[model samples]
Target: MSEKILNLYLVIDNGIIEEFRACSYEVAGSDEEKISFLKKNAANDFLSSFKFDPPVSNSGKKMKYKQFSRLEKQGKQFLLFEEIFQKFQVPDSPLICLTPVVDGEILSSN
Candidate 1:
């Protein structure tokens, strides 16, 4: 039997999607490892397709890399939620609020 794997879908606001399928054994119960894997493998394509405005803090300033890393972790959480919602026929919501420009067309998930 083929082993079941977890699929991680990264969707840009422009409706571009990049999917990463990883074996459950690869993560080995480490969220950090999973995030690292996704970032290393998929971040370039995902980021290239969409403009990422750096997240801001309550102080209204751009957050640092550490904060961005935290956001990456949060993204993984949202990915799981989206996966579940998709399976149950629930409308999937945008995990991040951003306007994606694709092929001279502006797309917004809102």
Candidate 2:
């Protein structure tokens, strides 16, 4: 089956898209569950930049590591940040990477 997605209409801010999106997965659906999933994934991605060590012999020292409890807490907080953005819609800032999509996938950024 094809993957689902969240259709978010966001107001651009600064130079960002000002929308909900997952790191690797596409945001699918307009419901709270989908939005929350996107936020959670984004937070995980944001927190993934702080890894410094490898967990096991096979596992490499990838940036996306959840090592500490504090990191988990930070991830949760990052997910909640969407509320702030939703409350204050961004002003008329130019969208840099806005691209058209024929199917569920994005066409291109250029």
Candidate 3:
């Protein structure tokens, strides 16, 4: 039997952010499609309410590059919530509020 792996990711840009729940099943063979569906729907849902591109990335590069960046497309690297908060130094500011994100899930079978 083949092993299964799951990954959850988030993206933020231009003051807009999105969270996604992703899963992969060895029998399903639909991880890419699932991630794409979630991202597309999430993007469409937020488009009317916010100005930002959907979170999409290819997490399988040796050098770790953004997969969706093209001449006609805009893409960015996905980071964890703490990474974003640390990079932006939101913790030092008293006025900034940081919320805990425990929505990540990974189910693997080997």
Q: lDDT: which is higher, 1 or 2? A: 1
TM-scores of the candidates in the order shown: 0.25, 0.21, 0.20
lDDT at 9, model 2: 25
The residue-level lDDT of candidate 1 at 64 comes to 46
lDDT of 1 by residue, 50-69 (tens): 22233345796653434433
lDDT of 3: 0.31
In terms of lDDT, the poorest run of 10 residues in model 2 is 93-102
* Models sorted by TM-score, best on top: 1, 2, 3
How high is the lDDT of residue 108 in model 2?
36
Worst 10 residues of 1 by lDDT: 17-26
* Stretches of model 2 off by over 4 angstroms after superposition: 1-22, 26-30, 47-110
lDDT of 1 at 34: 43
Q: Per-residue alpha-carbon lDDT of model 3 for 1-110, expressed as tens digits?
A: 22332232323333333443332223233545544444444323322321222343477322211332332144122333234334334333212111111232222211
Candidate 3: RMSD to truth: 15.7
Q: Please, what are the lDDT tens digits per residue for candidate 2 over residues 22-96?
A: 222343444555546644443334323221121222453322222322444664423322443333332222111
- The candidates, ranked best first by lDDT, are 1, 2, 3
Question: What's model 3's lDDT at 25?
Answer: 27
